[model samples]
Target: MTATDLPAKPYRNTAFDASINNPSAYASTLDDSFAAIDWQASWLCHLNQLGYISKSISQLRGLKNDPAQTEKLEHTPDIIAKVLNTALQKHADALQQSLPQTKPALNNQAQTLKFVSQNELPEGEAYERFIGTTGNIPTRDNLHDLFNGSIWLTFPKTKALLNYYHMLEIKEQGIGASRGRVRDTITVFDENGAILVTAESSIGKALVDFDWQESLVAPRDKWDEPKQLNKQAQAAVYIFGHALLEKLLHPRKALCAHSIVINVTQDFFTLSLSERINHLDQKVADYMDALLSEPDVSPRKLSPLPILGVPHYWAENVQPSFYEDSQVFRSGRRSQS
Candidate 1:
């Protein structure tokens, strides 16, 4: 490869407390676990470079200034809300929304935050009803909730739209044992949704048609910053799932995302980071808007994307042989004549 073929940036992670990946802050340690994360494993250090990833790290202050303060820096709901709110306010008005303050773990309830009495909002009102009507997200202090809150900050519009649809379902079905197809689709996407933006609609079609090699392999170089996955390039993945983000913290080859495909113009690759994020935010929200417009929606609208196999996101994929793992990169849902 010529000099021009080389990527402009190198892998380096100067910020973010790696220990924040730990599920609990209560763990005692001085063993350099804080810096042990494989920050540079993703090409161009993409994982380390995500702006919201660091923002979700609430313990950065205590850990950076003094490792001893790990115990002192508890991620209470109020703190997590403030952190999310501060991060959200940094964006445009569309991204701006008030985070509900964290309520203490009342009546010996473990791992709870920003909660209300079970008697507070009728019997069946949970995730959607509480958020939609009471305007309060019933949460408790915990790692999982933190990741969910992080996603809300990242994709406020999409999250709100998901809640809106869930409320519609609840109104129709009344939170029965069976959530019906539409609710199931909303839940699946809410918990593990991602948006894959490609300049070419054919590329998106390849993924939807389960043309794994065509979408993931042959077009590998065409992905965002093939030379260095962080820079401006063709396509990008915007992860909107909080659970998926949590799983990615300790990235494994098996991890995947239920991805929504949004094809954009060829010039998309040239936009700034903020511009891309805002554009994807609006784009995905618009897609979700149209999706929920129909009463009968299906999770099939989302395509399966083995997130690790995304171009340079995982180092193992640098060698084409990595895609040979059929368990991870399956052949397809293609037809039989």
Candidate 2:
């Protein structure tokens, strides 16, 4: 046989494809439990060299707005107001185009960043009820950490828009957490970029639900019956959330789990999965232990499934669990006016 016609070499390794197949592998170190520390560091350095960190902040800044550091508070406030106003206007237009089912009236109030809605608001009153005072405006510090910058609006599919709005609510009012959307969305793309998978936010929220409970790795019993799955992740999986559809996009910056509660036992190490868990578990455990041992402090939750994953085998049994009266957006429904 000609050399050019020869079959490609077979790829073999002890590494499990589940973790590496995830997009989060390119963004964070949480999956390094089995990985050598040097290897993790080197890989992270390479990812950074590819401009992941800088690009993320740059995109986020564009989504929000950074008033260039100015010496005067007077000039800064006006600049900050203009920047935020611009973001609101752009988001408003995107929202108008997202839902074609309902006819929305363009309230003159959007230019001023007030709450307005259409009948098909996928996220409900969460954004409108966000507690921050509109007149207070946002601080320079707040502008720099804009969330949901990397996500794009896809018409007729309102989840992305709602998720982005959720990010805005959290940023504007400090109402909820802000790390999962990017990590989970990016993870999907990194793992199955070749496939055409559409991600719905309810599914992302289901992942966040698992994250909040520290129960991402559901035991096997939960998946045997499809009927038991929750409204979010079940649909996410059904829609092929595992496929990596946008791999060519720039990698996201690493996410860190913030303050969290913990109950570490000397025996807990024995409870871990044999080969599938990320080596970064120890670091996570350490952070949790530190927070739990401290007095007079609240721990912030971190995004799960970034570096490693929810442990695919463990997820085999997980069913989505939706809460009644929750503000989560279910698949289907968007209003364009």
Write the residue-wise lDDT of candidate 1 on 1-337 in tens digits: 9763343222122121233454345332222332333333342232212355453442453364566665565533343444333344343233332332211111211111233322345665466766665444544334456557656655555666677777666777886789888888888888888778888777788888777787888888778853344343557776777677667767889887898889888767776655666567668878987987776678876788898888767777878888889898886675222
Report the alpha-carbon TM-score of model 1 versus the true structure.
0.71
Query: What's the CA error at residue 300 for candidate 2, in Å?
Result: 10
Candidate achieving the largest lDDT:
1
Residue 249's lDDT within candidate 1 is 66
Model 1 ranges off by over 4 Å: 1-77, 92-124, 226-232, 335-337
Q: Kindly give the stretch of ten consecutive residues in candidate 1 with the minimal lDDT sum.
A: 103-112
lDDT of 2 by residue, 264-299 (tens): 322323322211012222333344334333443221
